[model samples]
Target: MPSMTVRNVPDEVHRAIRVRAAQHGRSVEAEMRHILESAVRPEGRIKLGSLLAEIGRKIRLTDEEIAIFKSVRDTTPARAACFE
Candidate 1:
């Protein structure tokens, strides 16, 4: 495989990438590879909105019910804790 070097990265962006790599228990190179994979890969994964829409479709919820479900999802404990 061919390799390429990315030059002239801003200091803050490099620092942020390093911090994220540490948080994910990955080497900086591995973390950058993961980021690139997510950006370039074509595999389908369940995103939150699409997952919720699928659930709504299965349940055949009314518009109001879907709105309420979205509200509850938005205010979920995990989401709230992430903000704090």
Candidate 2:
């Protein structure tokens, strides 16, 4: 395993990290390692719009219900996708 050192952290930050470490039942060193690992990890999250669109296709709505939904959707303009 490799080694690392962090220096000159503020008192407030150090206190907060200590508190958080205690809350998670971990040593400060272990908590810091976990935080660093998580920062580098890729997040696996689907875009809300794409997820909603997929669900929309699977379910059928009445014309009036769709009209109401469309009216709500119109409030938020969709952003242009990079590929288009």
lDDT of each: 0.87, 0.88
lDDT of 1 at 35: 95
Task: Score every model by TM-score.
Answer: 0.50, 0.52
Clashing pairs in 2: none
Q: What TM value does model 2 have?
A: 0.52
Write the residue-wise lDDT of candidate 1 on 1-84 in tens digits. 767799999999999999999999999999999999899887776689789789879989998986786687655456345654
Best by TM-score: 2
Q: Write the per-residue lDDT of candidate 2 for residues 1-84, one digit (tens) a residue.
A: 999999999999999999999999999999999999889877985689998777877786567877888787656768888985
Q: Model 2, stretches more than 4 Å misplaced?
A: 45-84
Name every residue pair that clashes in candidate 1.
none
Model 1 Cα RMSD, 1 decimal: 13.9
